[model samples]
Target: MNDLGKLEDLPADYRAELTSHNLVPLWPSLRGVLPPGKPRPNTRATFWAYNTIKPLLLKAGELTPIEKAERRVLVLANPGHGLEKMQASAAMYLGMQLLLPGEWAPSHRHTPNAVRMIVEGEGAYTTVDGEKCPMSRGDLILTPTGLWHEHGHDGDQPVVWLDVLDLPLVYYMEASYHINGERQTVQPGRGDRQYARGGMLPTPVFERSAKTYPMLRYPWAEARAALLTMGEDMPQQEAVQLTYVNPETGEDAENILGFYALMLRPGQSLRLPARSPACVFHVIEGGADITVEDQAFSLTEADTCCAPGYTAVTLKNRHADKPTFVFMADESPLHRKLGVYENRG
Candidate 1:
């Protein structure tokens, strides 16, 4: 490879003429856009401690009412992308949302796909397209793109949940917008109950479900139990993991991002291969030490972290007597859709 010529090396009049016509040369910046070996990602390894976020979130609740703020949230912005951008990774947006008791977040639908990982509190529920999904610690509630969703709480304390969304990508593509709507009429059946067990689905004998999203909420109890059962059944497996997928098609739960639950055995350390998609990890139960290349984050329950693409990550269960459960979200589906997914193990 040879050193590329700098833009300043070109004649001043030629540069002026090019600027006048809104034209620019690519040779000087070619290697930058087409970097060798791997991508020079701007997404860095970042961590957000739940303990630190909770206090600020409570203060936010006290400072602003639900009617005034609509959705009171504190974004877990990565410093690499600039805090103002409100992005956890290149394509993912993360925020800690606080909903106080007796409050309701009005109904609205947006273009970006989103999921809520409940961190704490009870008696809070999210109604997505009319299905009322109760909020429990570690539950995952989906508010997929263009689906009207709202939050309501009947509990005494403040309810906080980690909000993960594909907003950065959608906003970058200029398709990010929301439409307000009236309160939805609560539907009759819950999807989780209909598609409860593995290898079985509600027989759509009468007619196929017209709903684009059959299941909006994935209870943590089911996922945790599945991980425990798998751990016992397949003790030799390195990673006891389960993907959150659409039961009907056996595909990822949402289109742009992939969601999963991972379990680490007592005193176990698992190394994930370097893959070409940024990943976000949240501790659902127990503590774990996450190492992303040279950066290390000690994550307790409810804590979250992000790792950039093409970086090998290692996770270790800090507890020696119990298993550690983690919830992960990644850009794999989007990468595969763009035909750039890879695992460089």
Candidate 2:
């Protein structure tokens, strides 16, 4: 019997020999290294109400300038992810960025892939690699890894967007890099294609050297129309859904990150099968009761919730009318690459 109580009785030289050989005593650390069964993270169904934080965001905008702050963002930390600089969950980072009219977040690019889901306001745009893509509510703007991008708001109201990034993966790989650029604006007529509707890419330009999808902006009008059409054609249980994909190859936008939007009709509920990668869902419209494992989160518009990896989730909308829309981002691609990703009904 390897009794921990007898650890002190062991000879000092013997312990020294174990340490000198760089051996970790199994008795003292076995439980942690190998749990009895499946691993369970400390995370629970967590929610962040936008109404509760809106004033704080406004205050932040009033106190800080885009030039000084570089980017005025409030990171949404997952308490279960630990006390450190937690964002969204353990493997992803989420932040709400505010861009005021007449101000610009200077051009910069980093190794980690990023996406912005517009929460409120309009007439703001992000320039990616010389292409200016306008931003509006419900638009998804991709800031692919290593691409030069800057954000500016020209509208009357402040532009607010939720920033999601695979920053944890970047830190884990220690491959993070940021390069500042001289120009904040892209040349006019660089990205002049009209926003396509009904699952079409306005431009089919594929760069041989590109690391991400060439299309930068996915407008709300197109998404909403397609989703409604999908609702009518697909099973009523999962009414509507769409995944942002690469126009060049018709695959995921990026290998390390994925973005998807879904809609559930009134009084509808669907249980999502478990998968290896965790995800954070931003409530875009209506309200839903999102249950993860045994815990539940009642989420409303502008609110966000999370579902840890491999945890069973069910989304329910009990409203008499109005469908619920959710935008979610996940790190499933990494797990899939490692051959550890799994999903089933």
Write down the RMSD of candidate 1 (Cα, Å). Answer: 0.7
Per-candidate TM-scores read: 0.99, 0.88
lDDT agreement with native, every candidate: 0.96, 0.80
lDDT of 1 at 292: 98
Predicted candidate 2 versus true structure: per-residue lDDT over 1-345, tens digit per residue:
434434456688988998899975666665565556445655555778898778899899888877789999888888887647666665688889898888888899999889899999988999988888898888888888888999887889988899999897788888988999867556554222433543454453763434345577888777777787778777544537788887657778777878898988878888888777788889887888999988888888889987887788899985758888889898887778888777854
Error of 2 at 176 (Å): 1.4
Query: Residue 86 in model 1: shift from native, Å?
Result: 0.8
Error of 2 at 161 (Å): 0.5
Tell me how candidate 2 scores on lDDT: 0.80
Residue by residue across 1-345, what tens digits does model 1's lDDT show?
Answer: 658898999999999999999999998998899998899999999999999999999999889999999999999999999999999999999999999999999999999999999999999999999999999999999999999999999999889999999999999999999999998899899998898899999988999898878988899999999999999999999989999999898999999999999999999999999999999999999999999999899999999999999999999999999999999999999999999999998
Poorly placed runs, candidate 2 (over 4 Å): 1-27, 184-212, 235-239
TM-score for candidate 1, residues paired by index: 0.99
**Cα RMSD, model 2:** 3.2
